[model samples]
Target chain A: MSTDIAGQAKKMGYKNIKVYLEGEPAWSKAGYPLYASNDFISKGNIVLIDLRSVEKSEAGRIARSVTIPSATLKDKADSIPKKAPVVIYSDSEDEAVSAMKVLKEKGLKKVALVPGNIAGWVKSGGETTSGPVVTTIVWKRQMEKGEVSITDFLKVAEGSATDTVILDVRNQDETTAGMFKNAISIPLDQVGNRKGELPKDKKIYVHCTTGARAGMAAKDLINAGYNAFFLNEDISCKDNTCSVTE
Target chain B: MQKTLIKFIPFLIMASFLTTGCAQTGTTVPQLIPQHGTSGGSRIQDRPYPIFVGNVSNVSNKAKVIAIDVGKGADAKTHLVKFDDKTKGIEYAVVGHASIINYEMRGGEPWATVIKAKLAQLPSGVTEIKTTELKSLLDQGTKFTLVDARPAKRSIEGSLPGAVNIPSDDFKAQANKLPESKDELVVAFCGGPT
Candidate 1:
C-alpha cells in the first residue's frame, strides 16, 4: 500500500521516492515501542494503563484507563489478560518503556505506549479524567450488530427451542463430512429458489463454517419474508456433537 | 403521426408494467438484469454475484470488517462486509479509499469475497528500501524525510522514530507536508505486505 503512495508522489513531480516496504510491523517486532493514536487510545477496545505515580494519576489520567503504577505493575501483571492489547502511559518515556518491557517479559503480547505519554495525548486534543483512579481491570468483548448471541444459537442447536430451525447453508459436499442432526441443509445459491420449502412461522437460524455463507443465506431468507437470523461465529459438528468458539 | 403513436401505445404500456413488476417484487431483480461488465475477467462467470464499486468509508482492523459507501448523496448506502483470511486482496483496503468488491449478501449486508485496489503496481520511479538499510540511515542521522504512508490511527499506534505521517488516502491534500525541495530524498512506508 505504501507503494501506492510513492506512485502518487512520483506523479506530483517529485523525483526522489523510496519505499520502506517492510513498514510498521517490522519496526515494532524489533523491540521498539509504538505510539497509540489518540483515537485508538480513546476508543479502541484495549486496556489503557497509567504507569505514573498515583499522585499524578489523581491529578489527571486518560479516561477509561486503569491505574497500575509502574512500581506495582509486576505484582498485578498476572491479573491482566495476556491476550488483551495493552497501552501504558506515564509522565516519563523511560518509565512507560520499562513498564511495557515488563509486560512483554510476562508474555503479554500487543503492548504499546502512548506517544509522549499523557502529555502527548493532551497535546493531540485528547481528554482526560481526574479523580480516584480505577484499579480493577474490567473488560468485555463487544458483539457486532445483527449477530445472534452464542447462547441463543446453542439453545436452538440443542433442540431446546421448539419454534426455531437450524438452517445449515454449507455445500452438500461439506455437509457429508458432518452436520447437526437438527439442521436442514440448503446450499446458499439454492436458497433463493428453495426458500418456500421452509416454514415461515418458525424462526430460522443460519450457520455455515465461518458464518459468511450463513450471513448471506439469512439475508436472502429475510428478504423472502422469513423470520431469520445468522450466527456470526465459528462452529464445527461431527457425529451429532458440535463445538462453537465465541 | 397520430396513427403511428396509437400503434406503439400498447408496447409502451407493456414496458411500464415490466418495470413496476420488478419494483413490486424487489427480489432477485439484479440477478434478472445483468449489469454491464465494469471489471476485467470473465463477465459471464461473475454474472451471478453483484459487484459494488465504492470508497472504503471505515475499517476495523481488530474486528476484521470494512464498510463501503456504494451510493451517493441522498441515495447513499453503506455496506458492511466481514473479511477473514479467505477474503482475497483484503490487505489493500485502506480507510477513506475506494476498491472493487465482489460480494454476497446476507440479511442485506455484503460479505466480500474478493477486493481489488486500483493502481496496485509500484510506479517506475520509486525505489524500495530494506528494513536494515532504513535502520542504518536513522542511526546515522541521515538527512531525509521519512514518511509513514499508513492511516493516522495506524501511524499513531507506532511508526519509525522521526517519521512524518502522510496517509495514502489523503496524499493529494497532504502532499504539502512533504519537503519543499523536489530533489530532497523522501522515503515512504505503510503496513507492509500483509
Candidate 2:
C-alpha cells in the first residue's frame, strides 16, 4: 500500500512524501477513531460505499452507502467525490483492495479501507444489521498473488514478444493522455458487455493507471473464458517507451 | 487598464499618511536606513497577490544586466542575472542571492530546482530591489510606487510602512500594478534574508 501511494504521488509530481505504515486498518485496530459506521452514515463530506453486489448491499449496509459494485467502479470514477473521504468496504480484504486501486487512479484523496467489512465494524463495537451476509461465489477463475506481480509483468512488457498482449482498462481520457505500444484499451465498464473483443489465444495482461480497474476487468475476461491476469502495478507511457512506476 | 489605475489612485492617496518601515533584504549587509520609519510605518497599499512591495533603489536600462549583492557586510556576494524575453525584463533578484544552491535533502530539493527554473522566467521588466535601498528612498519621500511582495497576512502581521500587499503565489496576473510612468521608480521586496 505504501508503494502504491508513493507510486501515485511520484506520478503526480509530488515531492517529499511520507507514508503511514499499514495505513487506516492498522490505525483503526489501534482504536484510533476509524470513522464508526454510524458516524460515517451522517457525514456530509464523505462518500461511503459498499463495493459489494447490489443484491448484497440491498440485504444490509451502513446507511448512505451508494452501491456501484466492485466490478463497475472503474466507469463511475467521476461519481465518487475527489475531495472527500471515500470509504469502501466489501465481504473480504482483497475485495476492498481492488476498489482502492480504482479510487487511487482517479486521484481521490483520503480514501480508506474500512478496518473490517461491515462484519469487522460489528466486531470492533460498531453497528451493523443482521442480514447474515451473502458472500459472492468465486465461480470464475481468479488471479492468485505472485502469479503476476508488477516486476514480472514489466519484464514481459519490456521483452520483445508479440504473443503477450497488455490490455489497458482505463477510460478514454486516460488512454488518450498516453498508452503503451499496441496495448488494447477496453475500459472496465465495456469489458463485461464487450467480452468478445478480448483476445483468448494470447497471454493477456490487464492494467489500468493503477491496477484496481484492471483487477476487476481481468476477472471479467477470465470468467468469460479468456486467458487474462491483471498486473498489480503502475504503468506510465511516453511515445513508444512504456515504463513502470517505481 | 485605465480603470485599474483609477482604482489604485485612491489607495495611493490614503497611503500618503503612511510611512516607510524596515524590511528584510535577505542579505548580511547592515541596513542602510535606520531612521526612516519614525512613526513605525503606515498601512500598505492594496495590491494583487504574488507582487511585492518596496521602493526602487536602482534602474539601469543602459546596463541591461541584473546585479545582486547577498551575504554579510564584508563577505557580501554580488552576481549578474541575465535578462531575456522570459524574465519580463527584470534586472536582478537582489535578495538572498547565491552562486550555487545546495538545496536541503528533504522534499524542498525539487522545489529548489523548480525555483531555479522559475527565477529564470520571472515576468519581464520586473527587477527586484533590496530592502535597505528602498527604505532609504522612502525616507527621502521619493515619489515611487511601492508594492508588498508578500501575502496580505504577512503585511498585516507588520509590513514595511507604505507598500501595497499582494496575495502570495499569484504574481503574474497582477503585474499591471506597476506604474505606467517608466520614469517613476518602483520596487517590490519581501521576506528578506531567511
Candidate 3:
C-alpha cells in the first residue's frame, strides 16, 4: 500500500514512497494549497463553507467562511450561489466529503472540501471572527510633546489642556475608589456603542488602573481615526503618587 | 388541525413571553468563580474580582459553561471564557487566544466572596467593584506581580516594576523559565485576558 510504502522502501521493499516525498515538498514549496487537517479536502477557487452551529460561531468562526450549520445545510444550500466555488468543512472531513458528494450528485459542479475542516484551519493559523461584528472606530495613540509619562496625563487631568476628553476604560469598580473629576467612565465592553458620546474633535486620553487596557482602547480608537493616547503610567486616587502597585 | 393550532398557539405565546420577558429583565449574571493560582493549575474558588461569568448564552448544560475571567475592575471588561464541556448552551468552544490572567490574591474579601456579593448589588451583566476593596487587598501584602504576557520588546519599554515577561506565544517553549513554585503569586494579563 502507498501508505506504508515509505517504511517498506527504506528497506528496499518498494520505491513507491519516493513519489510521495517528492510531491510533498514540491507542493508546499510551490505554495499549493495545504490542508491543516486531512479531515477536509480543498481545491482551488472554491468557496469555504463553515458547517458549525450558531453558538460556536458566536465565539468565532473561520475567516470568510459562509456559515451554514450542518443540520440546516440541506435547507440552506440553495441560498448559496450555485455557480461559485463551494468548499465545505465541519468538525471533521467526513461531513465535508459527504457534502461534496451530495452536491455533485445533485448535478452541482465546482464543489470541494476544506482540508481538515475548521479545526485544521485553526491549527494552520487561520483567524476567526467573534460575536457580532460591532463597528468601532479605531484610533492610534500619538505621544504628545512632553507627555511621555503618566505624570503628563495627570497634568492634563489638572486643567492643562482645553476641551480635552479623558476616557476611563476601567470598569466602574476601578473608578469607585476615585477617578479624575469630570472624567467619563465607559467600560471597555460598552465603548463600541458609546463612541458616539466621545468628542471626535477633542484630544482624547485613555487610562486604566494600569496602562494595558488603556493602551488597547487607545489603539482601537486610533484605528477608528481618532486622536487618542494611552496614559503610559499608573495613576490612582489611593495617593497623589502616579505610580501603581505591582 | 384547527384544534391543534389552537392548542399550540398558547404554548407558542407562552414561549414567546418567556423569551421576550427574560430579555427585558436582562441577562442573568453568571456566578463568578475565582481561581487562586496560575492558569494551568487554577482551581475555581468561591471568589470574585479575578473571575466573572458574563455573556451567558446558554445555561442548560452546567458542564458546557463557558465562563471567563476578564481581569480586575482596574482593567477593561474584555471577553475571556473558560469552557467546561458539560455547560449548557455551549454548542461550540473557542479557546481564547489571549493568555489567561494569572491572578495573585490581594486579600480583601477574597475575590470569590466579593464577586458574588458585588454581582448581587450591581445591575445584571455589570460587575463594578469599589476601589476600596482593591486597595484593602493591596494593603494586605497580597502583593501582585503583573507578568507582561507580551514579547521582550514590549515588556522592556513599559512594564510594571518587577513584572516578569512571559509572552503567551512563547509560554510553551519557555515554560521552564517560570518559577517551579506554584505558590508564588503571579498575575498574568494579556489583551484584557483575551
**Model 1 in CAPRI terms: which quality?**
acceptable
How many clashes in candidate 2? 20
- lDDT, candidates in the order shown: 0.71, 0.48, 0.43
Lowest lDDT 10-residue stretch of candidate 2 chain A: A134-143
Cα DockQ of the candidate 3 complex: 0.01
Tens-digit lDDT track of model 2 for B102-154: 12222211111111210111122333344345446756988765555555533
Residue A104, candidate 3: Cα error in Å is: 60
Per-model TM-score on C-alpha atoms = 0.55, 0.26, 0.27
- CA error at residue A132 for candidate 2, angstroms: 51
Highest TM-score: give the candidate number.
1
Model 2 chain B lowest lDDT segment of ten: B109-118
**Each prediction's interface RMSD?**
10.4, 25.5, 25.9
Candidate numbers sorted by DockQ from highest down:
1, 2, 3
Q: Top model by DockQ, which number?
A: 1
Worst 10 residues of 1 chain B by lDDT: B19-28
Q: Sorted by TM-score, highest first, which candidate order results?
A: 1, 3, 2
lDDT of 3 by residue, A28-125 (tens): 23322223222222223345667777677667776556667777667666655454446567786666656655655555545544545677667866
Please report the TM-score between candidate 3 and the true structure. 0.27
Which wins on DockQ, candidate 2 or candidate 3? 2
DockQ of each: 0.27, 0.02, 0.01
